[model samples]
Target: MVLDTVMTTLHVLTGALWVGSVVFVAGVVLPAALDGSLDAAPLETFADRLVYGSRAASVVMFLTGGHMAGTGYTFDLLLNSSRGHLVLAMLLLWLVLSALVEIGRSRLVEGLQEKRVRSPARNAMGVFRAAAVVGVLLLVDAGLLASDVALY
Candidate 1:
């Protein structure tokens, strides 16, 4: 029980951090950078920090989530249950979110490395936007799983 609690807490905390950071960059930082209000150096620094922080959060979420799921779920339950379906949805959304962040960061970094700010910001904006959307969906999925809302 204690292990389950710890795992759940870690999973929730990491998920929030991962999603929140992505949303902040996509909604706030990227726009400023794209409009020339933000400098390349700051943008580069933010991108690097966001990417590294996200990577760490992703790792934590994976480990904690795996521990919880491994102890609580079986293949049959996962394939046949509504809660299980939500879990699967969360997993898919998590993958999409992670990929989008990485791709967006790469786009921004590649542009920054070239000493160009606005163009790279513009290039990464769409990807980050997608990530933000996915992040929201992931949150919703998690809420549904946690709440009494019926998936069916």
Candidate 2:
């Protein structure tokens, strides 16, 4: 029981970190970049920091989520339960967000390293916006899963 609780807590906390970072990037960083309030070099540095933090949080969430699922849920429960469906959705969302952020980061870093005149900020902002939307959806799903009201 203690182990399960620990795993659940870790999973929630890590997930929150991942979601929060994405939202911040989308709501704050992207706008600043778009508005010229943030220069390319500073934007790139901020993105690097966000990527590093998000990557670490994603790994922790993945591990803890897997552990929680394995220890606390049966295959049947995972297939049939509302929480199971939410978990699956969250996993898919995580994958999409991770891929978008990593690819965007790589492209941005390459452009910056080459000292190209054109900035990748536009592309990065688009990616961050998409990820933020998905993150919000994941949060909604989590809230629904946690609530006592039946979803199905």
**Top-lDDT candidate index:** 1
Provide the TM-score for each candidate, comma-separated.
0.95, 0.86
Lowest lDDT block of 10, candidate 2: 111-120
lDDT of 2 by residue, 57-145 (tens): 88887898889778867888778987778778878888888887787677666666654414666657677788888888878877777
lDDT (Cα atoms) of all candidates against the true structure: 0.89, 0.77
* Residue 74 C-alpha lDDT in model 1: 91
TM-score of 2: 0.86
Identify the runs in model 1 with alpha carbons over 4 angstroms from their true place: none
| Candidate 1 lDDT, 59-106, residue by residue in tens | 898899888778978988778988888888888888888889999999
Least accurate 10 contiguous residues by lDDT in model 1: 143-152
The CA root-mean-square deviation of candidate 2, after full C-alpha superposition on the true structure, stands at 2.2
lDDT of 2 at 127: 76
TM accuracy, model 1: 0.95
